[model samples]
Target: MITNGMIAPVNLTANVNNLNQLQNKATPAEAAESFASFLKNALDSVAAQEQNVHKVNDQFIIGEANVNDVMIASSKAELSLALTSQVRNKVIEAYQEIMRTQL
Candidate 1:
């Protein structure tokens, strides 16, 4: 359930399914792997969204779609990419700070 207060929920079912899948894992290794998988899945989702924007833009140029659809897709893609970038930056910062620890 990621929200930025700008876009309406597009796929609640996908988020619910992801949460359900994560709940079934109990072991430490399973949890770690599930977390990694979750991040990968999120990245894949944003990539798909960016691809959708490109598709919509192309369709608009071809007279098959309109500006509104393209704008919506583009905004969604932009927000998702920004969110992904922030998460990645935070992860890297945490790793670096951990490396600086004494022991």
Candidate 2:
């Protein structure tokens, strides 16, 4: 079990070797496709959460769901949206940074 405030130890050299191997083996197109796939999955998850919140809200309105369930669902949807926005902003930032590179 992981304890609170605990940091897992990592083998830095192994990680560097693994990353170098990936960089050498993977083509730019493959990397782009992988990133696109990951982004799409994240978006789908956020959409799913939003749909769930809507469903819970409707249920609550119909007296089938409790206030607590509605609140939790809404909060989860809001958090998912916030995370998606942050991730998008970070990707944009990275793209801009790459554009500014001389090489």
Candidate 3:
């Protein structure tokens, strides 16, 4: 969530004596909605990049685009997909860890 080359600071301090109050900071529904929206946006961006690659490839075939454009688009799509996969893996790992916590 960087804006204008500046990263926003996050307030992550937790009151060690008030562990129970932490759960009230964000409702499960609100968290879910935000997470779902973020994931949908990320997936949509990746899909758009893939489509761009395809379009560039087709344009190159028709002599309307150069190899450089096609290559750049392909690389962007590849990187985005790879990043998405890594994020998915990390999310799965975090979920599994949370499931393993003792009550």
* TM-score for predicted model 1 compared with the true structure: 0.78
Candidate achieving higher TM-score, 1 or 2: 1
Instruction: Estimate, for each residue in 8-93, the C-alpha lDDT of model 1 and write its tens digit.
Output: 44563775687677778878788778777777778788988887888888888999877777788898889888988898899999
Best by TM-score: 1
lDDT of 2 by residue, 13-68 (tens): 74345445545545888766655665566677677778877887888899987887
What lDDT is reached at residue 58 by model 1? 87
Clashes of each: 0, 0, 0
Candidate 2: C-alpha RMSD to true structure equals: 8.8
lDDT of each: 0.78, 0.67, 0.68
Q: How are the candidates ranked when ordered by TM-score, highest leading?
A: 1, 3, 2
Off by over 4 Å in 3: 1-26
Off by over 4 Å in 1: 1-9, 12-24
Candidate achieving higher lDDT, 1 or 3: 1
TM-score of each: 0.78, 0.69, 0.71
